[model samples]
Target: MGSLIDRVGIVTGSGRGIGKAIAEAMLHEGAKVVISDMNEELVKQTADELKQKGGQVLGLVCNVTVTESIEKMVETVVNSWGRIDILVNNAGITRDALFMRMTEEQWQAVIDTNLSSAFKVTKPVVKVMSKQREGRIINIASTSGVHGNFGQANYAAAKAGLVGFTKTIALEYASRNITCNAVAPGFIDTAMTQALSQDVVTKILDKVPLGRMGTPDDIAKAVLFFAGPGAYVTGQVLEVNGGLYT
Candidate 1:
């Protein structure tokens, strides 16, 4: 049997990209997973695909930034599965701009979606996990947050905030057997990166010792380690950056 046998996991923004990869990894390990995203069609499509792979899946539309939507999603998950063993805060967006050129709206939008959404979603999930005395929370962060990229002021701040949130949750919930950690991915070859010009991609990748962009599965593997029942680590930030120091 897989390590996560019957664990119930909620992966936000799981319709595609890294989020979808993480959800797929958990499902392959025998977890019942919730594929949640703001895009209802994408959520349904992802859930259907996973189900065809023999996974026990649920698709829910959730706007993590909204308290009402978050509460509803949490309620639905609990009603269906009776418990939540894992929560992956994988939903995020980027609004790239230099700090001087960044607007208040851009900063707030990124903060609300990437950082504050965790506060909204985790409150109720943590309550449920507390009662159960066991749970895992993995927040998807970014290397840009750590090293500070030139054109990603808002995105960087939001992800950096997420890292802080992860550590605080870890400290506060350790006694409850709930582990919270962050996974900071570096130069991942996702849809976002694919949009960059080859020159830009090459320039970014040249700094990596491995000389290649990381894959979604690379991030998923790290997440799986944290999500596994046997993990004894918490309050840590694991950088899955193909030997890239920055």
Candidate 2:
């Protein structure tokens, strides 16, 4: 759909993984994307590769945990494009450990990156969006957050918090034409999951009814549903799992 044609959108952690997939999907449907990530080298590489496809993209170095970092990043985009239409809070990290063994720093880091980072970036973007009275904000959460898992206290907590935040913001801005939603993904083949042993991966999938892991494209498509579908869907969590939670 060219509904997003020539529009400016930003996806965090876009150097790779699901974030990259979302940006690519938007571009396929005709949207100019700003790739945001903390990794400068990876950002440039992804930007260059997308440009190879004739995608209009810009690399933005951002650390979502820091207010100034997000401030400067948003300012740069507004200065360049003059309008920010959609934002996907896909940047996150994990420090999996038992509750008894989890360090304060580990817990704090996960919360900052996964949860607070959404706030830090969304606050500014929402201001601009509210002014226009139309916008899309999609936050990437996890199935692990919905159904808590062992050794992932921090990750689960932060992701669950994001779902709550999404719902609240959606309600607060319902009349302003600003839609906020969350996408909870199950297993996806990415660098993070690849780090797990084959046995662990298999064990995890054994519980899924679909008998297979999901892909980044699976999550990306769900995100696109919220981005340009032009429906009044909001404050909802679309679980892109293999029917695991069902």
Candidate 3:
């Protein structure tokens, strides 16, 4: 519930889905938000739509897998906003296959997109945030990372890596007053999940004690907490999963 007036934030992969929800929530809190995605059209479209929320918005095309692309995105944000106050590493993908059937390409693709991108994106942001001595970093993780999933070895491993990375960042940046945390969402009804077969979706939802899937807003609110009033919290993994795991 803390006001983020004048704060500047960046939500990567924020053209749609949970990432877009996070950007909207930050805008609602009065933060200037940069919506970054690999898709130029989608990012521009989302930025235009979010302007109705009455906050400054910037749309940037960024391929998270490439270091040069990430550097440019960070440069643009800093040039426009002066400093970055919040960063949400929400760019991720899933290449699912049983371990026995998983290919090297699939494994590396998920790792590079989901796990490696964090290191690439955050490296430059950390420099600016450290100089300012104030910042928030929230990684979008998944329950599959916390509790292994059936056909998502690559995804689960990448998310699990995020959990560790979050802690390490918190420890490293504590002295500089930067907080790092992870939000592990469970069975959120995103376009990704909606694409699953009905039976598969039903089985996943059956495990949720809430008896329904979580919404993008559910995940967004959690990100907001860490960015705002939850500033004292660091090195924590908050499961926004409605009794699914806890």
Q: Show model 2 residue runs off by greater than 4 Å.
A: none
TM-score for model 2?
A: 0.97
Runs off by more than 4 Å, candidate 1: none
Checking candidate 2 for backbone clashes, the offending pairs are none
Q: Scored by CA lDDT, what does every candidate get?
A: 0.94, 0.92, 0.93
TM-score to true structure, per model = 0.98, 0.97, 0.97
Best by TM-score: 1
lDDT of 1 by residue, 1-246 (tens): 888999999999999999999999999999999999999999989999999999999999999999999999999999999999999999998878788999999999999999999999999999999999999999999988888898899998889999999999999999999999999999998887887889988888889999889999999999999999989999999999987766
- Where is model 3 poorest over a 10-residue stretch in terms of lDDT? 1-10
Q: Please, what are the lDDT tens digits per residue for candidate 2 over residues 120-205?
A: 99999999999988889999999988999888899999999999999999999889899999999998888878888899898889
Cα error, residue 141 of model 3, in Å, equals 0.9
Q: Which ten residues in a row have the lowest lDDT in candidate 1?
A: 189-198
